[model samples]
Target: MLAPERKANDDFVYHSGLKFALLPAYYLPVWFQAIKGDSAVESGIHILPFILALVVATVLTGVLISCIGYYTPFLILGICLAAVGSGLLTTLGVKTSAGKWVGYQLLYGFGLGACFQTPNMAAQTVLPRNEVSIGASLMLFGQTLFGAILVSIDQNVLDGQLANRLAGIADITPQQIENAGVTGILAMIPSEYHEAALEAYNASLRVCFQVAVVVACLALLGGLGMEWRSVKETHTPDDESATEEGREGGEKDGKVDDGKEEV
Candidate 1:
């Protein structure tokens, strides 16, 4: 059985990694539309680098873990990389170049991909075969739960910042801004206030990223708590059962031979 403390640690790392991975999904598109003036479709295209990197890294990490038979290292390294990437994202601005944003997204995506599945893998390693499904379900539940909570927090942060920063601007009320939403607020505001509005959006988004950085760093605690058990070092239930069966057959044959010799 897995220790309760270890299981908690695994869940923590899993939840944090998932939050780090998901927070960007909520803000990046809005950033593109609000700051870069890209349409919804274009914003989606702009984030392709992040998506591609995540996919490639996830596959690569799985293969490497399978070969190396250790996961704790990846969890630590991934959190470190994610923290750096989240920090970099805070540097994005209205005038920031495409190359920098793309690079940052790639870095963040790869970092998230590296450790995203590792918690589930660790759960399987420590759990009984029959209970592995339950462990996986719990991990997924935590991921979904934390992902929703953090995204909502990010939205609230963004909304609150917008309300505070754009408060002094004439001809635009907070209600109007709220109704306009992140992508439409700029369009709704007067032309002169465009720069201020964009700055507000950028700064607010930076705060969200800063929050992500803190979350990523906190994930390290869980990573450190993870047991260094190797996948290859553990025997499957099937293997143990087969070994037992063989031993039983050998013992039965020996008893038969002893009975014949006595007769």
Candidate 2:
């Protein structure tokens, strides 16, 4: 039989927690490079807002959960915010303002960090001492699996969209664009077709962002059904049994005292 900690409800926690962990990883740098015209180093630097926001949010979430002893509320709020943030990111265009992109990234990154570790929290808190590792492993496995799958899917979507858009450009084929590499795409294609190619690439990236939004929504739905249990430390079964024995002994002594008084 499945252990108590390995039940269907735990699956819900894992599923919801896995969605946003790597959602931004797939497209954030790509968007910066393809649309924003940043070099590899510049692209990485441009995504700093999201990374920093995630770091702050993660630390805050850990502290809040430690203090409040409940992770469900954070999980719910985080997933909802992530969904909304991702949806907002879909509005990004070739000429979008820097402020808008930064703000959107902060929102999405914070949301992702707030609940990304919730499944692990659930595992550690809900499982027995010996089973905690098992619970944690389950959550980790789900998270890693989702990360690989979603990122690959995003890449495929980007490639497919680019292929369709560059079909009749006459200057270059989608294969060359893909193989020419991210930085060399413009060099491989004719100069006259560069603007159109860029626009198509931007549109494809938007589609990738849309996928993240959908995943976040699905995670939000899963989070809604999670049980709102506390993560506070509690007594072990052995401690509870010893306390029960002490109470019984006290009751017996009281009964004997009453019998003696009646005599």
Candidate 3:
């Protein structure tokens, strides 16, 4: 049985696709990364957690990246925790890790889910009270803009791949096309059609796939830059001020403070 945490993370990642049906093109692979364990397995079924995590991670990610504004720090921290969860799993050995990976995945998602919006919230908190509306506008704008850019990039990459694949098998038979899924579709073509189809498909799709890989690589780069600040780490004056103001006023006050000052 999967841990509650794993279930949560998987769901979270999957929900990210609510933005669109095809969004999986980008996020589905995140799941695979965890199971690959640096490609530890030669072949066959890797951990099922990857798929679940992919669903949860992507879903929460959309919320975090799109909805949350200034809370980027907290989100960063949450990701760290998630990594720890995965790390703990890895450390646990295969069976144990497999079992615990769920906790790691869920806690990571739940912990971060609350914080997904923290960045924007933080940004708004940090800004002057009068600037709150402006801050929000900007935050939402950035999210929408990035969404547009990435969506376009994703479509182009996919279109190129499809076009190439179709062209490669210019003489593609009904049988070959029927068997095609994503990866296996091309491989299934009969030997007679394989060469031309591969040439055309590979030629066309390679660039798009390459670009898709590049974009994925860039996303990974963002993860590389993540360094979660621990509780012991000193916060900026803005965060301190936000806290002080929150204490003075209370929870609502904290929200007010977050809106008026920095978090």
Choose the strongest candidate by lDDT: 1
- TM-score of predicted model 1? 0.84
Candidate 3 lDDT over 15-100, as tens digits, reads: 22212222333332322332222332421133344445555654666555444333345454544544343333323222234446
- TM-score of every model? 0.84, 0.82, 0.37
lDDT of 2 at 230: 77
RMSD to the true structure for each prediction, in A, is 5.0, 6.8, 14.3
Which wins on TM-score, candidate 1 or candidate 2? Answer: 1
The whole-model lDDT of each prediction reads 0.78, 0.74, 0.42
TM-score-superior candidate, 2 or 3: 2
Ordered by TM-score, highest first, the candidates read 1, 2, 3
* lDDT, candidate 2, 55-97, per-residue tens: 9999999999999989989887877777777788888888899
Task: State in Å the error of residue 252, model 2.
Answer: 26
| Model 2 TM-score on a 0 to 1 scale | 0.82
Model 3 scores a TM of 0.37
